[model samples]
Target: MTAITVSRAAQIRFSPGQWLTAGLIVAFLGLFLIVPTGTVIYTAFVERGTGTLTLVNFADFFRSELFVRSFWNSVYVSAMSVVWGTVFALPLAVLTTRFDFRGAMVVQTLGFIPLIMPPFVGAVAMQLLFGRNGTVNLLLNDMFGFRIPFMDGLNGVIFVQSLHYFPFILINLSASLRNIDQSMEEAAQNLGSSGFRLMRRIVLPLAMPGYLAGASLVFVKVFDDLATPLLLNVKDMLAPQAYLRITSIGIADPMGYVISVILIVVSITAMWLSAVAMRNKDYSTVQRGGGGMARRKLTTGQSIVAYGIVGLILLLVLSPHIGLFLLSIATVWSFSPLPDGFTFAHYGRVLEDSSVYIKNTLIYASLAGLIDVIIGSAIAYLVLRTKLVGRQWLDWAATAALAVPGVVLGIGYLRTFYGVTLPDGTPLATLWFMVVLALAIRRLPYALRSCYAALQQISPSLEEAAENLGATKVRTVRRIVLPLMIGGILAGFVTSFATAAVELSATLMLIQSNADAPIAYGLYVFMQSAAGRGPGAALGIIAVILVALCTFASHYVLERSRRLVEQSHGTRH
Candidate 1:
């Protein structure tokens, strides 16, 4: 019997418990993500009222001059954002990883600061700082007698988005650079390859996979982004058009559904392009005696230049945080370099009246995070541990959510579930739980990756040992697998919570009232009005604080746990 059990486990045969877990996950994903998205796609290709299959909706989309222009504009903005993001990221990544730059850790840490604040929240603050009559231009006008159009029209959207998202590139590129075997660089150096020529030829191509990964992410993110372009008032973009069509025109409008289809297609196409670029190219270099690339010391001039560049990027990244803080307290900050006076009235008002946003965000994000980890863990376990038929399909399904835009998902939910009335006669889509579901589906891929990492680190032998001792599979998982994954589960939960707290695109559509709004939705509503900017800035600050605290706390706890484990091992030795 023991031999049979071990053999079955080795063969990856599905047990009753595994089957049950997978069934639950499949039902959840089908009910929430697949169904809604499918509804949007089906509606896009079908004739309205009659539900007859037709291509007229897509043809209408192509015929619309506004939509055609919006499509191109979205493409241009997304591509340019990737280009600018690469520019901001490349130097920092190279300087830290290639050379022994001082404060490399600090540079990397600070590089990630912009990610905590949603790009849309920074749009208003950026306008204040980089607008025509704003501080930077004003200073430039005074000093150089010329003002650069840093925040004009589409330029403003690209600038803020690039500054906010470049960290994605920085992180991936730096890791890639670090992983390049030192021997490869040494061999190139022996052939008299040095300096920029060597780096361009040898180093970059090796790290292209990582670069493409990050660039693809930046492209898709910028492409699907609704709030940033909306906050910037650049509505001649696909995402904003989709959003406006649904909310302004109505959810039944095929234009909105058509636009959502285009968004998903574009996202998939970009990812496919990235994959195609890296396909058939072997980048593996690490071998025996080859750990990572060797770091070289920078010269005095090089150090100064590197530091200056890093400092400038850091300042630009931190500008939103600084400007948000200033805007929140400023009595009146208009047509000037500084505020007329300072007051905490904005914060007070937010805390007093708009505290519901914060409360809702906490509830929604917490619930979303909970859902993600539970589902993510199950998928990860099924994929890694079981050789059950189609186990990998579950992972692929969950990860597919990454390509679906938030606005598209929102439209999907409205179209698919709004007609499904509850026992209370309320539209199913209007319920706050639907908002949580949208958030979870949107962030599920990230949480799934985290769970995969956690589960991968655990040994199958541990479970096998438990099972050999007559413990049931469920009991072993409950006693050993879950406890071991606590750290990763917590980490995944915090990540989902932090990101979901500021996710507005879907929430914006789902929010039936201000009472059900999350921080991101409330921030958007607040940023829309001139009078509401101050309160919006205050709310933005609170969101930044909330995400920062959660991220920092998770990092601190994980690090502390690692230290404790190391200490225990050291004492044992």
Candidate 2:
């Protein structure tokens, strides 16, 4: 008999498996994307009295000048903030990555401190530091006999947001800068190119992709942010306008939906344009193995100036959080460099009544984190590994959540689930399912990005070898692929947990009264009361500690896994 060897393709039929995967994907999309979006559209149209469709809501939104002003204001604020953020962050990234300097590690860590604070908390800290009666103003009045206009209008909002988000640009650009090959710069320098000229020609172009990505993210984040504007009293912003329409006015108002739709369109368009910019450029500057560290000793004056610049940036980024932390421990923080009185009363209050917020935040964050990692890993695998049709679109769709603001998504949920009834006639007004789904969807982009990046680093040959050895696709994926991806998945999980814990805008809208409230919401409420500030500060402190713990855990796990992988590689070598 002729030696008959069945092809691996014959062993694994692409037909059934592909169809099943596709079906599962379709079901997932329908449950998460289609149903929630459909709810928004359905509620926007359905008339209350007649139970018929109407366009009055949209019409009112268009006709309202206040709404129009808010839309324009949001655009202006986002544009201004992005410009300032880039200006501040790009140089910082260049200094940290290109020039050898003291305190670089401290500067980098300081830059990222703002990322841990809740949006409203940042705004509140800004208010405390710069408001008319704030510490700066009080000092100025004491010494200069006049008050400065610092915390009001569009300017304050832009300043706070830029301070908060510039790190995004810094981190992205620094990674890109570190990845640039020294050979190119060495060649340029040998060709009689001056330092400035070399940077302009050789470095900037390579870093443009990362710069653009950071800029795009900042724009989207600032554009959709509600807390800063609201706290700063910038009434003319898109997010607060949407909130006013949904909560202050009513969901029946079309103005909110209109603003939401506009915000979505703008954010999506920005993301698409950024993606295009990234696609056209070879961002492989940061790829593995080719580019190594290029550390150059700086002259005395240059080193001093670099250290000074880093210190200034660190101060700008960290002062607000420092102020907040102090305020959290104080009986009253007004006008003094030190608190009026130091007390642990705030911490005690938080500890005593912490059950509800703590439980809710942990439960929701844990659930969302777990679900996001599982679903996001599958999506990443499907998009990166398989040659499925529309995989590109699926990848895009999965990440599309990044463009949707928390406020807009919350409103979309409100609109979609307004009248959704349970099996009984009672209307399902409080849809925790939809809330959890929204959190998962909003966080999916990060999880997917982390997973996809990790997946890309892994060799596909391992999977192919397993299959050739008669391992089923599912078995191979479970035994081989997942083990390699544990680090990435854990990273995603921690990120999701951190974000879900601090998430404010969506939780504000979706959380039902008499139900559990997350720490962010509780902090907001506590901040408003006389005794509330103490508890609020306490909650904020707890949140910071929790986030720090999770981040450390993630780093530890990832590092251990990486060491194991490296040892295995060494043994094989």
Question: Which candidate has the top score in lDDT?
Answer: 1
Global Cα lDDT for candidate 2: 0.78
Write model 2 residue lDDT over 42-160, tens digit each, in one string.
66566657768887766776688887788788889888888988877876888777877666776777777778878677777777787778788888999999988777778788878
Candidate 1 per-residue lDDT, tens place, 1-573, comes to 999999887786567888899899999999998999999999999898998999999999889999999999999999999999999999999989888998999999999989999999998999999989888888889899999888888999999999888888999999888889899999999999998899999999999988999999999999999999988889999999999999998988999999999999999999999999998989988685347788899889988898999899889888988999999999999988988999999999999989999999999999999999999999999999888789899999999999999999999999988999989899999999999999999999989998889899899999999999999988999998987787788788998999999998899889898888889989999999999999999999999999999999989887877687678769999
- What lDDT does the true structure give each of the candidates? 0.92, 0.78
Give residue 105's error in model 1 in angstroms: 0.8
- Superposition error at 505 for model 1 (Å): 0.6
The TM-score values for the models, in the order shown, are 0.97, 0.91
Consecutive 10-residue window with the lowest summed lDDT within model 2: 1-10
**Over 4 Å off, model 1:** 1-13, 288-290, 567-573
lDDT of 2 at 413: 69
The reply for model 2, stretches above 4 Å from the true place, is 1-12, 15-18, 38-62, 276-293, 335-337, 423-429
Error of 2 at 98 (Å): 0.6
